[model samples]
Target: MVVKPDWLRVKAPQWERVGNVKDILRDLGLNTVCEEASCPNIGECFNAGTATFLIMGPACTRACPYCDIDFEKKPQALDPTEPSRLAEAVRRMKLNHVVITSVNRDDLADGGASQFVRCIEETRAVSPHTTIEVLIPDLCGNWEALEIILRSQPEVLNHNTETVPRLYRRTRPQGNYDRTLELLKRCREFAPWVYTKSGIMAGLGETDAEIRQVMQDLRGVDCDILTIGQYLQPSQKHLQVNDFVTPEQFAAWQAFGEEIGFLQVVSSPLTRSSYHAEQVRELMKLYPRQRV
Candidate 1:
């Protein structure tokens, strides 16, 4: 593993704010990807009174090698009450924009799309003013399941193409690069009014050319937002780090992505899918949501 650089270091968490956020989640029995995935920006996000909620189980059906989420043989039954609890958390936190993601629940027929719908409905019912964004799995290529979630009409529909195509087999064995692209394409076709966003992680042995190609492919599907971040290995058991991409390179990629017509591009070493997500609201102002 490559040595973690100083730039990757972050200030210690503001425990007072983190404690408050944790109390809300713990009190509501809600989960968050920031805690589950061990995101490096958890302190900053939580301290700012913002967090990406992780629904479903902490365990995932697809055990991607580079991910920190646990893999389970068979998970428990979906919690029907989770949606209400999550809504209550949003209400208590007083968040204007909330992000809800889930572990891949391939065990269910609809890949847990119904649960997502319920969450959206419940959140909207409780906090009608909040804008929702969902970062979802591919639903095992079930376009029907994808449609179910899209029908809920989140402000942003984010699905990460976590790494380059060449590393797909090793890093994300159950994931198909073509399928990922097709999912984004279908989102545009099925819900042209919704803003489609995708993210990628670097430093997993992919070339800059491959990264640019991925950007081009996303643009081909009319993906509106792009985020690029450097991948950090979670543990010794996980995939080893291949490189630490420089901040300068990340800025160059952001410039390139914007030049190619992306409405918003968040690219940096520390940038994650939901980093500074509140800023995405600006897109709504730039291109107000239109009925299709």
Candidate 2:
């Protein structure tokens, strides 16, 4: 087992505020990607009253070895009430920005695109001012399904590249690297107004060169935002950590991403896709794009 470096260690969060956020999520029966994916920043995000809401599941359709979310159990039926409850959570939390993500529901015909539309609409109904971002699956390359969600017009549409193309088969066996890039490219083509975002997890054996290439690929598709974070093994059964990237390297990637024209790049050891995601509200003000 590889030992974690001191820089990767997380600061303990204030339990009082953390508990308050948990209380609201439980009361409304909502799930968050922060908790489900075992994100190291859960405490800090919860303490600050922000969470990336995981809709359609705590269960996923694909069994990616690196992920902490469950895929063994039978997936549940879509909960029609989930969107309203999620909106209520936003209303109660008074979030200025909200992120809605989901497990890959491949069993559904549209890969749960309709559910995403409902969530966006419901959230808007309750909190019109809240900027919405959706971290979505590739919808099995179903561009039509993607269009359904894109039509809802969330402020940001995020899909993770997860790892470099060379690692896709081992790390994300079911995910297609070309298709992942195509999804982001199509998002820009279909909805020019929405900011396109993608993330990559470093330290799963990808070299610094490969990482930079992925950034270039994303930028080639006009991706507006990029986040590169270190990968942590969820458990012994999951994929083992190959390396722990240092803080300086993360800083270098941040600098490189910005130089390549990414409007925002959040890179660090503990930076998950949605870490400090609310900051995008300010990004919008600085580089606002009108709906096309």
Candidate 3:
């Protein structure tokens, strides 16, 4: 077993605020990636009243070995009331920004893209001021499905590459590196106004050169935001941690990303895709892009 480094330790968060956020999610019966994915920063994010809403699931269709979200259970039918309920959570929490992501719903023809659109529309209806970001799956290379979600124009569109191409067979067997890049490229082309983002996980036995190549690939697609974080093993059955990337290394990646033209780069041991994602609101102000 690999011992976790001191730099990876998370500060204890205020329980009162965390509990309040949990209560709302429970009351609304909404799923958050924070809980489902066993995110290291759950307490901090919940305490801050922010969550990446996991729509159309708590059950994923694909069983990615590194992920903690459930795949054994059968995926349930999409709930018609989910969008309004999620919007209600946004209204009650008074969040300045919200991230709506989902488990892979490959069983559906559109890979749950319609559900994402509904969530966006409902969120807009209830919390018009809350900027929205959608962290989506690749949709099995279904460009039409991609178009459905792009048309809604979430302030940011994020799809994680997860790891380098060489490790895709081992880490993300069902995912394709080319397909992932195409999705980001298509999102940029289809919705130029919507900021495109991608994330990469470190400590996956990937060399520094491999990580930089992935970052370069993302930049080639004009991805506006990039997040790089250390990957921790979710369980004994999951992939073992290859290494614990240090803060200094993360700083280097962030610097390189900025030098290469990423509008914003968040890299650290604990940086998850939606970790501190609300900062994009400020980025929007600094590098304002026209909303089509």
* 10 residues in a row with least lDDT, candidate 2: 1-10
Distance from true location, Cα of 211 in model 1, Å = 0.3
Between candidates 1 and 3, the TM-score winner: 3
Candidate 3 positional error at 244, Å: 0.8
Candidate 2 residues lying further than 4 Å off, grouped into runs, are none
Off by over 4 Å in 1: none
| C-alpha local distance difference test of each model | 0.92, 0.95, 0.95
Tens-place lDDT digits, model 2, residues 100-178: 9999999999999999999999999999999999999999999999999999999999999999999999999999999
Q: Quick one: ranking by TM-score, best first? A: 3, 2, 1
lDDT agreement of model 3 with the native = 0.95
172 in model 3: Cα distance from truth in Å? Answer: 0.3
Report how far residue 87 has shifted in candidate 3, in Å: 0.4
> Candidate 1: which pairs clash?
none
For candidate 1, lDDT tens digit of each residue in 119-232? 999999999989999999989899999999999888889999998899999999999999999999999999999999999999999999999999999999999999999999
Residue-level lDDT for 216 in candidate 1: 98
Query: Candidate 3 on 1-292: residue-level lDDT in tens?
Result: 5789999999999999999999999999999999999999999999899999999999999989999999999999999999999999999999999999999999999999999999999999988999999999999999999999989889999999999999999999899999999999999888899999999999989999999999999999999999999999999999999888999999999999999999999999999999999999999999999977
lDDT, residue 235, candidate 1: 91
Model 3 TM-score (2 dp): 0.99
